[model samples]
Target: MKVEIWSDVMCPFCYIGKHNFEKALENLPFKNEVEVEWKSFQLDPTLNPSETKTTVEYFKEKKGIPEAQASQMVSQVAQMGQMAEIDFNFEKALITNTFPAHRLIHLAKKHNLSSEVEEALFEAHFIDGENVGSIDLLVSIAEKLGIDKEEAQKVLNSDTFDQEVNQDIADAQNNGITGVPFFVLNGKYAVSGAQPVETFVNALQQTYNETVSPFKDLSDGGTSCDADGCSI
Candidate 1:
C-alpha cells in the first residue's frame, strides 16, 4: 500500500500528525508493505525570508489577534505537541517561506531519503526553531541525512526541484486538499488532520480488509455463450 501525505513544514499539526501516523503504522500487521511519500505544501508562499518576526508575531499581525491571544494559541499548540512528544519552540520559530524547504524534500525523494529529510526539516522549524528558508541551513540538514553534501548544495543553489515542488502543490490543489496533514491511502481513502492514532489504525485496517487480492468465483461455468456456440 502507498500513502501520500500533503503537508507543510511550518504546520504544527503536520508534525504531530506524522507521529500519530507512524504509531498507527507500527501497529499494522503489514507495516513493511507500506510506502509513504511526503508531498510539499506551503502555508505561506509569499512570505519573505528577510522578515524577522517569530511565529507569534506573524500570527498577531496577520490575524489581528492580540499578542496575549496569539501566545495563548501557540501555547495550545504546544500542549498538542506535548501529546505527541514533540517540543515545539514556537516563540523562536522563524516565520519565513517554506518553498525552499519543500524543494529540499523533493530532492530527497529522488535519493529515497524523503522521510529522513522531512523529519529533520520539521524538527528544525518546529523544535529547533531554525530558519527553514535558508539554503545553507537546508543543505546542512540534507547532509546530516547521509545525502551527498555537494549534490544537496548544488540542488539548493539552483532551482532544480522548483518545478517538482510546484507540481506537488498543484496536485494537492487538484485533489481538493485545503489543509495540511492530509493522508491519502492507495489513492482511494483519505484521512485529514491530526487525527488520533486509533483513527489512522482504523483507516489502515479498513483499507487492508476491503482489498480483495483475488477475484472470487461466484458460480460454476456450467453454461456459457460464445461467438461460436452456447452451452446448455
Candidate 2:
C-alpha cells in the first residue's frame, strides 16, 4: 500500500500524526510492504525563510487569537506530543517559511531518505527549536542522514528540487486540502489530522485488503513444489 502524507514540519500536529501513523504500521503484518511518502505543504508559504519568530508569535499573528489563547493552544499541543512520545519545545521553535525545508525533503527523496530527513526536520523545528529554513542547518541535517554534504548543499543553495516541492503544494491545493497531516491511503482513503492510532490501523487494513491479492487456499488440492519435494 502507498501512503502519501501531506505535512509541514512547522506543524506540531503533523509530527504527532507521523508518530501515530508509524506506530499503526508496526501493528500490521504487512508493515514491510507498505510504502510511506511524505509530501510537503507549507502552512504559511509567504513567510520569509531568512526571518523567523517564535512559533507562539506566528500563531497569534496568523490566527488573530490572543496571546493567552495561543499559549493555551500550544499547551494542548504539548500534551498531544506527550501522548505521541515526542518532546516538543515550542518555546524555542522558530516559525519561518518551510519551502526551503520542503526542498531538502525532495532532495532526500531522491536517495530514498525522505523519511529520515523528515524526522530530522521535525526534531530540528519542534524539539530543538531551530530555524529549519536555514540553508546551513538543512545541509547539516542532510549530512547526518548519510546524504552527501556537497550534494545537499548544492541542492539547498540552488533551485534544485524546487519544482518537486512546489508540485506537492499544488497537489494539496488541487485536492482542496486546507490542513496539515492529511494522509492518503492507497490513493483512496483520506485521513486528516492526528487521529488515533486505532483509526490509522483500521484504515491501513481496509486499504490493504482492498488492494492486495489474498492468499490462495491451495493446501486443499493444488500441487506445489518446495525445497523438500513436489506435492503428489
Candidate 3:
C-alpha cells in the first residue's frame, strides 16, 4: 500500500499528524508493505522570505486575530502537540516562506532522504526556531542527512525543483485538498487533518482489506445457493 501525505513543514498539526501516522504504521500488520511519499503544500505561499516576525504576530496580522487570541491559539496547539509528544515552541517560530523548504524536500526525495529532511525542517521551525526559508539553513539540514552539501546548495541557489514544488501544490488543488496533514491511502482513501492514531489504523486496515471490491456488502447473508442447498 502507498500513502501520500500532503503537508507543510511549518504547520504544527503536520508534525502531530506525522507522529500519529507513524504510530499507526507501527501497529499495522502490513507495515513493511507500506510506502510513504511526502508531498509539499504551502500554508502561506505569499509570505515574504525576508519578513521578520514571530508566528504569533504573523497570525495576528494575516488572520486578523488579536495578539492575545493568537497566543491562546498557539497554546491550544501546543497542548495538542503534547499529546503527540512533540515540543512545539510557537513563540520561537519564525514567520517565513516555505517554498524554499519545499524545494529542498523535492531535492531530498531524489536521494531517498525526503522524510529526514521533512522531519528536520519541522524541528528547525517549530523546535529550534530556525529560519526555514534560508538557503544556508536548508543546506545545513541536507548536509546532516548525508546529502552532498554542494549539490543541495546548487539546487537551492538555482531554480531547480521549482516546477516540482509547484506541481505538488497543483496536484493538491486538483485533489480538492484545502489543508495540511491530508493523507491519501492507496490513492483511494483520503484522511484529512491530524486524525487520531486509531482512525489512521482503521483507514489503513480498511483500505488494505478492500482488495476484492471497493463497494462493501454489509448484509450478513445473500440469496446464494450452495452445493448442499439454497439459502433463504
Candidate 4:
C-alpha cells in the first residue's frame, strides 16, 4: 500500500498526524510493503517569508478573531498536541511563508530524505520556534538528514523544486483537499485531519485486506461452518 500525506511544515496538527500515522504503520504486519510519500501544502501561502509574529497574533489578525479567542484556539490545539505526546510551543511560533520549506522538502524527496526533513522541519517550526522559511535553517535540516549540503543549498537558493512543490499543492486541490494532515492510501482511501492512531490502523488494515476481492454471494445458500454450528 502507498500512502501520500499532504502537510504543511508549520501545521501543528500535521506533526501530530504524522506521528499517529507512523505508529499505525508500525502495527501492521505488511508495514515494509507500504510506501510513504510526503506531499506539500501551504497554510499561509501569502505570508511574507521574513514576517515575524507569534502564532496567536497571526491567528487573531488572519481570522479576525479577538485576542482571547485566538489564544483559546491555540490552547485547544496544544491540548490536542499533548494527547499525541507532541510538545508544541505555539506561543513563539512565527508566521512565515513555507514555500521555501516546501520546495526544500521536494528537493529532499530526491534523496529519499523527505520524511526526515519533514519531521525536522515540524520540530523546528512548532517546538523550537525556528523560522521555517529560512533557507539556512532548511538547508541545515537537510544536511542533518545526510543530504548533500551544496545540493540542498542550491535547491533552496534557486527555483529548483518550485514546480514540484506546486505540483503537490495542485494535486491536493485536484483531490479536493482543503486541509493538512490529509492521508491518501493508494490513491483510493483517504483519511483527513489528525485522526487517532487506531483510525489509521483500521484504514491501513482495511486497505491491505481489500487487495483481494470479497464478492457477494450470488448462488443458492452455501454451506458454511460457524462457531455455534454448521449450516447443512
Candidate 5:
C-alpha cells in the first residue's frame, strides 16, 4: 500500500496527523509493506521574507482575533502537541514562508532522506523555533543529517528542486485539497484532517484488504456543491 500526505511544516495539525499515522502504522500487521510519501503544501504562499511576525501575531492578524485569544489558542495547540510527544515552542516560533523549506524537502526525497528532512524541519520550526525558510538553516540541518553540506548548500543556493516542489503544490490543488494533513490511500481513497490513530489504522486495514479491480466500477458517483461549482 502507498500513502501520500500533503502537508505544511507550519501546520500543527500536520505534525499531529503524522504522529497519529505513525502510531497506526506501528500497530498494523503489514506496516513493513507500506510505503509513505510526504507531499508539499503551503498555507501562506504570499508570505514575505521581511515579515518578522511571530505565529501568534500572524494568527491574530489573519483571523482578526485578539492577541489574547490567539495566545490562548496557541497554548491549547501546544498542550495538544505535548500529548503527542511533540514539543511546540510557540513562544519562540516565527512565522515564515515555507516555500524554500518545501523545495529542500523535494531535494531530500531524491536522496531517500525525505522523512528525515521533514522531521528535522518540523522540529526546527516548532520545537527549536528555527527559521526553516532560511537557506542557511536548511543547509545546517542537511549537514547534521549526514548529507554532504557543500552539495546541500549548492542545491539550496540554486533553483534545484523548485520545479518539483511547485509540481507537488499543483498536484495538491488539482486534487481539490484546501488544507494540510490530507492523506491519500492508494491514489483512490482520501481522508482529511488529524483523525485518531484507530481511524487511520482502520483505513489502512481497509485499503490493505481490498483488492484493486480494473473492471469494477467502484465510484460513488455522487454530486456535491462547492465554491467553484457543483460537480459529480
Candidate 6:
C-alpha cells in the first residue's frame, strides 16, 4: 500500500494526522510493505517572506476574528497538540511562506528522506519556532538530517524545485483538495482532513487487502462533507 499525503508543515492538524497515521501503521500487519510519501502542500502561497506575523495575528486578520478569540482558539489548538504529544510553541511560531520549505521537501524526496525532512521542518516551525522561510534555517535543518548541506543550500538559493512544488499544488487543486492533511492511498483512495486513527487504519487495511492488482481505487466516491460544511 502506498499513501501520499498532501500536507503543510505549518498546519497543526497535519502534525496530528502524522501522529495518528504513524500509530495506525505501527499496528498494521503489513507495515514494512507500506510506502508513505509526504507530498508538498502550501497553506499560504501568496504570503511574502518579509511579512512578520504570528499565527494568531494571521488568523485574526484572515478570519476577521477579534484578538481575544484568536488567542483562545490558538490556546485550544496548543492543548490539542499537547494531547497528541506534539509540543507546539504558538507563542514563538512565525507565520511563514511555505513555498521554499515545499521546494526543499521536493529535493528531499529525491533522496528518499522526505519524511525525515518533513518532520524536521514541522518541528522547526511549529515546535522549535524557527524561521522556516529562511534559507539558512532550512539548510541547517537539512544538514542535521544528513542531507548534503551545501547542495541543499544551492538548491534553496536557486529556484531548482519550484516547478515541482507548484505542480504538486496544481495537482492538489485539480484533485479537489483545498486543505491540508489530505491522504491519497494507492493513487485512488483520498480521505481529506485529519480523520481518526481508526479511519486511517481501516483505509490502510482495505488497501493492503486489495493489492492483487497494481491499480486499485479504494475511494468510494463518498461526499466530502464534514460537520462544518463541505471540506475544502
Q: On residues 59-175, what C-alpha lDDT tens digit does candidate 4 reach at each position?
A: 888999999999999999999999888989998788799999998888878888888888889899898999988889988998888988998898899998888889999998998
For each candidate, what is the lDDT? 0.90, 0.91, 0.91, 0.89, 0.87, 0.87
**Winner by TM-score between candidate 6 and candidate 2:** 2
Which portions of model 3 miss their true places by more than 4 Å?
Answer: 211-232
TM-score for all models, in order of appearance: 0.90, 0.90, 0.91, 0.91, 0.88, 0.89
Candidate 4: where is the Cα deviation over 4 Å?
212-232
**In model 2, where do residues sit more than 4 Å from their true spots?**
213-232
Candidate 2 displacement at residue 226 in angstroms: 21
Model 5 lDDT tens row, 1-232: 8999999999998988899989999998799888889999999988885465698999998999999999999999988887788888988888888988887888788788888898899889888888888889999988898888898888988888878888889999898998989999999889899888889998998888773433655687788799999996
Task: Put down candidate 3 lDDT per residue, 12-39, tens digits, no spaces.
Answer: 9999999999999999888988888999
Higher lDDT: candidate 1 or 6? 1
Clashes of each: 0, 0, 0, 0, 0, 1
RMSD, every candidate, angstroms: 4.3, 4.2, 3.3, 4.4, 9.8, 10.6
What C-alpha lDDT does candidate 5 achieve relative to the native structure?
0.87
| Residues 105-126, model 1: lDDT tens digits | 9989998998889899988988
Query: Per-residue alpha-carbon lDDT of model 2 for 1-232, expressed as tens digits?
Result: 7999999989888999999999999989999999889899998888987799986798899999999999999999999899999988999999999988998999888899988998999999998988999999999999999999999888988998888888998999999999989999988899999998999999999899877755545476677899999988
Task: Give the 10-residue window scoring lowest on summed lDDT in candidate 3.
Answer: 208-217
